[model samples]
Target: MFGDIMGMMGKLKETQQKIEETKKRLDFVLIDEQSSDGLLKVTLTANRTVKSIEIDDSLLDDKEQLEDYLVLVINKAIQKASDVNEAELGAVAKDGMPNIPGMDLFK
Candidate 1:
């Protein structure tokens, strides 16, 4: 019984170490998400950095349309960033504790 407990403990510790290493690795990756329309683009790094943004040239031809599309694009980018963040966090949470309830894991 004691041996089994020790084995489990060691396993848990190793798993934790792996999780930490994965988090560090995530820092180097950029999880990009965007909309089907070229107006909305988001490039978010795993470290939570916003890298760059691009807007469509045609939208600039119309003032009101440009403003509307700009707002739409920003919102979409933010939503996409949130989704990527949540998914990554969920993966990490499941890797460690898959049984925890109310673990929105991202929230």
Candidate 2:
């Protein structure tokens, strides 16, 4: 009984370590997004940190249009980053989880 608990605790600690490592790794995982017309582009990490933004000179002429493009493209990039972050962390968590009777946390 206690042995099982101790083993589970150890597994949980290892999982936490792996989660931290995965988060660090995600900083290098880049996600790119752009506008449909190709006037704006964004690059970000899976950790949701923006790395770069490229805008065509034509977009600089219109404030509202540029704002719209930025909002759309950045939002798309954030969503993609979020997906990657979740998947990576989820896989690590799921893989490290200890199987407990009737818990079924991953399901």
Give the candidate number with the greatest TM-score.
Answer: 2
Cα lDDT for residue 40, candidate 2: 96
Count clashes in each candidate, considering only residues at least 3 apart in sequence or on different chains: 0, 0
RMSD, model 2, all Cα superposed? Answer: 0.6
- In Å, residue 31's CA in model 1 sits off its true spot by 2.2
Query: TM-score per candidate, in order?
Result: 0.52, 0.98
How does residue 101 of candidate 1 score in lDDT?
58
Worst 10 residues of 1 by lDDT: 98-107
Candidate 1, residues 1-107, lDDT tens digits: the string is: 68776776776676677677766776677655554666656666665667776667775678997677656655665666567666665576566543335655544
What candidate 1 gets wrong by more than 4 Å, as runs, is 56-107
